[model samples]
Target: MALQILLQLIVTGLAWGSVYALIALGFVLIFKATDIFNFAQPELMMLGAYLSFTLITALKLPFLPAFLVTLVLMTVISSLLEMMVIRPLVGEPVLAVIMVTLGLANVIRGMTGLIWGYEELQFPKPFSAQPIMLFGAAINQAEIFTILATALLLVVFFIFFKYSRAGLSMRATAEDTSTAFLMGINVKRVFTASWAIASVVATIAGVLLATFTYLEPIMGHAGLKALPALILGGMDSVVGAILGGLIIGVAENLAGFYLEQYLGGGINEITAYVIVLIVMMVRPYGLFGTKEIERV
Candidate 1:
């Protein structure tokens, strides 16, 4: 019984963690590109999910078509936001930019509630809710799809960042924007591209989460939940986001199961933060993050 429950938790946690990893990836990408820790990412996740729901449920579109369209729409929105809001604020103080992101988050949140209503709604289930038997453990079908899709995106990004010209441009810009511009790269375009990429990732994560849980404006909270994953994985590492997400997910599940029995409920909610504190104490650079050397 114990072993079975443990396996169940692991599978479930991985699915949930994939969502966290994807959202965290958005945070990392934006931060790498612009050095801004976007607090609006989770709201973007919520917005993405709502967008999917609008395309499928309201517009009566097929799942695949809705999904594709949502990605495109998110990409456009993200780019436009970068051009209008982010670009204008370029060279501004970091604190001022952060305030913009925070304000943007609230604006997105209010817009979501205003458009979709404050009520919770059921999201379209793209996959069957059946559980498949794997090594005598029943794994959720949606979860299987979730992890597979996440892995596929990760692979795509790996190849993209490694081999593509635009990828090189992004890396160069991330390393040093002025230098990249000096080398003839369009730094503004790169920032827009980064936001578009993050938006697509957010759309996928939002869909996965909508599948995992019900749809609601409140679902955007998952974005905020991803911060700990970024901290755990290193704020700038892509693979670190995935690793941190899985670790946080599994730890949260385990804590909820075992620790809850002793500490009551809600330990899962705080488990990732706890891990962040403990891990930082031992490795301030995070599990996969590069430590910065500052000179006086």
Candidate 2:
């Protein structure tokens, strides 16, 4: 019985970890391209899920078409956000940009509540409502699909970043914005594209999360939880984000299972933060982040 419970917890942790990875990826992608830590990413993701839910449940649209439409709309919304809020902050201090994003997150959360109401809404599952059994443990089809889909999306993004022309432009911009501009790269356009891509990624993550949990105005706050993954994986590494998420997920599950008996309630929520604190104390740059040198 003990072994079976442990196995089940591991599987559940992995599935939830994948969702965290997807959300963390959005934060890493936008930060990599623009050097701005977007606190609004979680809210953006929540908005995406809500929008998708509205399309499927309220408008009575089919899943396939609704998914595509939601992606496109998220892309547009992200781009517009970049233009209106982020673009003007070019060359501004990092603190200023971060503060702006914090405000943006609050604005998004309030706006979503105002528009959609504070009620918890149910989201339709993209897959059939069946549980898949593996090695004496069972997980819902939606959980399995969400994990697989997030992995596939990460692969696609990896390929795009490595092989595509636009991907090269994005990298170049990240390397040195002024130098990229000198080489005729449209820095503004790249920033817009980064934000758009981040939004789309967040939207997908949100949809997946809504599959397992209730959807509400507060759903976006989950993005804040992803900060631990970002810190663990390094802010600039997308691959690190995925790995960090998995580590955090597994660790949380294990703690909940093993330590809950001693620690009582809510240990799961604090597990990631505790891990981050330890990691920072040991290695501030994270697992994959480049070491920084400071000069007096």
Backbone clash count, each prediction separately: 1, 0
Best by lDDT: 1
Reference-based lDDT, each prediction: 0.90, 0.88
The TM-score of predicted model 2 comes to 0.96
- Residue 137 displacement (Å), model 1: 2.1
Query: Which run of 10 residues does model 2 get worst, by summed lDDT?
Result: 130-139
Residue range with the least summed lDDT across 10 consecutive positions in model 1: 216-225
Model 2 scores what on Cα lDDT? Answer: 0.88
- What global local distance difference test value does model 1 have? 0.90
Q: In TM-score terms, which candidate is top?
A: 1
Query: For candidate 2, lDDT tens digit of each residue in 1-296?
Result: 67777877887788778878888988998898898999999999999999999999988999878888999999999899999998899889999999999999999999999998999987887777777777767767777777788889988988998999999999999889989999999988999999999999999989888988879999876776688988999888888899998888888989988998999978988999999999999989998777889999
Pairs that collide, model 1: 42-223
